[model samples]
Target: MRIVRAGHLPPLLRLPDGHTKIPGVPVGPLLGIDATARFPEPELRLAPGSVLALYTDRSIERRDSDIRSDVERLQGSPALLGGGGPDDLADGLLRDVCHASPDRADDIALLLTEYAPPRR
Candidate 1:
């Protein structure tokens, strides 16, 4: 997959064998900010059963804590803890990470894409 960061966070990559990493995608200017800007499209090859996670900052940002720490904490989030399917992960992240408290005022968006080859 080729990813172009338009001022967005690098996607979280989780391998089927339990390896996880946040790719170092180059950050580009926000969309429409510069029409002549060319963003770098970093290519990545994902093995079968690998999962790519895309989420907004609100998913990890908190007023009482450090964002950098929160970013690293994502690896331990409920969604990435086990081998749960995307649906289960979505629910867990929304419950435990994004919606831990309804009093906060931050919109959240998360997407999980899994690459699974047909079984032999």
Candidate 2:
């Protein structure tokens, strides 16, 4: 799998045994500033049971929360680390984090996908 983020935090990847945060490369500047900016593409091989979680900054940002801690908490959550389908995991995460408060100032967007390489 390949991931590309212009100016966003890298997504999280959870394998059957453990989890890891994908690192982002040094890409070009934000759009509108440099029209000729270029970015390098990086690829990764996903295990059959690997689960990838992608989200926007709003999902983890809060008025009184540490971004790193919040991300770590989400990554270590039982619902995410536990065995389950992508939909269930996504729903659980959103329900736990997004709906925990009613004063969110930004929109929360999340996408979860499971990697299952085709049989040869």
Query: Each candidate's TM vs. the true structure?
Result: 0.87, 0.83
Give the Cα-based TM-score of candidate 1 against the true structure.
0.87
Considering only N, C-alpha and C atoms within 3 Å, which residue pairs clash in candidate 2?
Answer: none
lDDT of 2: 0.75
lDDT tens digits, residue span 1-120, model 1 = 898889886688888876688887898989899899999998888898888899888877877778677777886775686687788777877887855446668778899988887689
Q: Candidate 2's residue-wise lDDT over 1-120, tens digit each?
A: 767667665678888775655545444456566778776668867888888888877887776777877778777777787778898888788877865555887789998888988989
Off by over 4 Å in 2: 18-20, 23-28
How high is the lDDT of residue 43 in model 2? Answer: 81
Cα lDDT listed for each candidate: 0.80, 0.75
Clashes of each: 0, 0
Best by lDDT: 1
Error of 1 at 6 (Å): 0.9
